[model samples]
Target: MSRLVQRITASIRFTPACVFPLLIGGSAIAVFLAVFLLPVYAKNNSLDRAIQDRREALERQELFAPIHARLTMQLREASSLVVGDRQDIQDTPKSPEEAVYKLSLLAEQAHRLGLLGVTPHPDSLSTQDNLAAELRLAGPFPQLRDLLITLLAQPWLHRLERLEISGGADVEEFRVGVSVRMDEGS
Candidate 1:
């Protein structure tokens, strides 16, 4: 094997023929890399960019996960507590006449619940398509609480926007503001 190695090394020389073949082989390798390996590298880089984009999207979703969860829970709780006739909201008021009738009916209901001096802001309905009403009530604290509970349970999707309760032991003076969407469009 040593003799063969020596003979092989001695037979090879940097002649024109030997140098010519080496140059051709090196050129062929260069051509192969330019034709195939370069495009493969570009495609690999594109895939890495796509993976980075997906990772950024996943990070954003994770960041908002708690807010999404809280909103879902609140919606579920509100849906579960509805205890009024849904039909009351089927007719969206198209004119002042209809709006007045609805307000009167609502006031009557409030009167029955020991609430008085009910007034609705018509401008609120025209401007924002929301039925905003204010009421004054002098009653026991338990009655005031019951009214608030009933308002929340109404199927019209009404919410108490603001409330002020001032009283001691016997009589409570309550000032309340409530609002509901006029219809699906509003």
Candidate 2:
């Protein structure tokens, strides 16, 4: 053999075992990092991002605190109006027949406010203390706008779930459905 080959063979034969073991150990560490440690690191990063998103949502809710407080106060005041002034609402119809009478009175009141024609329909009586009514009104555009403003300004809680307005030959007419829920305890 050449001098270089003889030296290489002698080094491999003597210090040999440690070189092979080191190579294998380095490869095992690389495989473990690729297959196990890398994925765990990626998962931790994703979890951190999710936590950040939740913190931002909580901060947004805190920013709306004043608006939420004001709305809650308005709702409480409206509810009290219905229950507190019992005398004013004492004549409100209790029976189905009487309810229809009261509805007519409300419709007439609407008509006087420049609404051309007003009609109110009450559904069948339920065991619950809730009352639901549908009101249909027809008139000029300006008058219809005014009527809606007045209805919304009422002290009682009235939810206008749906409103349909159509243009007619001489005027615009509106069909509105209003629902009122009264607690039995009230």
Candidate 3:
């Protein structure tokens, strides 16, 4: 084996033929890498960059997850409150007489709340389109405010059409009118 190695090393020489083939083979391998493997490496690098960008975007979205959850909970709470208010306003009077009776009851409630001369004028109310009436009451400013709030807080679709207030600062007279309508869709 030692003799063979010596012979092999001695036979190999730095001639033009040997150097020429080695250079050609080396150039061919370099050309193959440049033509095929370089583009593949470039594409893999670009894909890695894209993956990194996506991971960063997902992390940014995770940062806002708590705010998104809080907003969704608040939205659900607001929706529930609106649903409760709609349920409260769902009470409707079946007929004009019932509507008048309800108005009288409201007037009595105002009288009980320290208002004097609580009167309801429902003579001009028509049942064909919508029920409307005017109420006259005399009381202090606080009682009038309370009566207005009570009227607005009733369990039906009620609209205040006109409001006229007159008198001194302490004892005020209110001529407030409201229009009541039933929802057809309900």
Candidate 4:
């Protein structure tokens, strides 16, 4: 046994030449695992998370589809009444007074479409031929809540830019700014 142990020690010799190669090989393997394998694993994990998020989003959209469809039909009916009328008024309202009158008329039409307390500000003009307006209304809190929910269900490209609700007001109303853009070529 002593003779065999002596032979093994002689083979290694604990020399710098053999020790340096072993250290270099071990370090290369460590670097390869850290830089290559770890990033691939991380990327696969991120992809899985992204796929899960998309699936959840699709499910929510499906749940909202029926409500969204009803709101869209209502919007289409209202929009058809207002679209052509706007073109005639757009080019003619040069003065602020004329603008206000046109805005009021537009608000009235909007009110008939389930929108309450529609008010169009004369100052809400844009350089583009976009109509800007503010609407205020007061009603039962439940009705207001339903209106907001329905608004969220609207499929139009419109956005509710701002909303203000307060308890002390004469009417429990929410104020919202509404705008619609006219295509230039039209």
Q: Which residues of candidate 1, in runs, are more than 4 Å off? A: 1-113, 184-186
Q: Which of 2 and 4 is the better model by lDDT?
A: 2
Tens-place lDDT per residue, model 3, 1-186, is 999999999998999988999999999999999999999999999999999999999999999989977875565455345445542232567655666666666666654343343343456344444677676777776666655555566645356778898888667777777776644443
Candidate 2 pairs with clashing backbones? none
* Backbone collisions counted per model: 0, 0, 0, 0
Clashes in predicted model 1:
0
| Model 2 stretches astray by more than 4 angstroms | 1-93, 111-124, 153-157, 182-186
Clashing pairs in 1: none
Error of 3 at 172 (Å): 1.4
lDDT comparing candidate 3 with the true structure: 0.66
Q: Deviation in angstroms for 76 in model 2?
A: 11
Q: For each candidate, what is the lDDT?
A: 0.66, 0.59, 0.66, 0.57
Candidate closer to the true structure by TM-score (higher is better), 1 or 2 = 1
- Across 1-186, the per-residue lDDT of candidate 2 in tens digits comes to 699999888777536777889899999999999999999999999999999999999999899988977885676566455436442242434444444455444545554333343333434256445456666667766655545544444433346557898877676667766654444443
Backbone clash total, candidate 2: 0
Question: Candidate 1 lDDT, tens digit per residue, 66-166?
Answer: 99779755754664465344432335554434544664454445433455676777677565456777777777776566456555554453566788988
Tens-digit lDDT track of model 4 for 1-186: 999999998887767988999999999999999999999999999999999999999999999989988886676555444443433233334433444454444434433223455555565554444556666755555555544444333232145567787655444656766554434443
- Which window of 10 residues has the lowest lDDT sum in candidate 3? 111-120
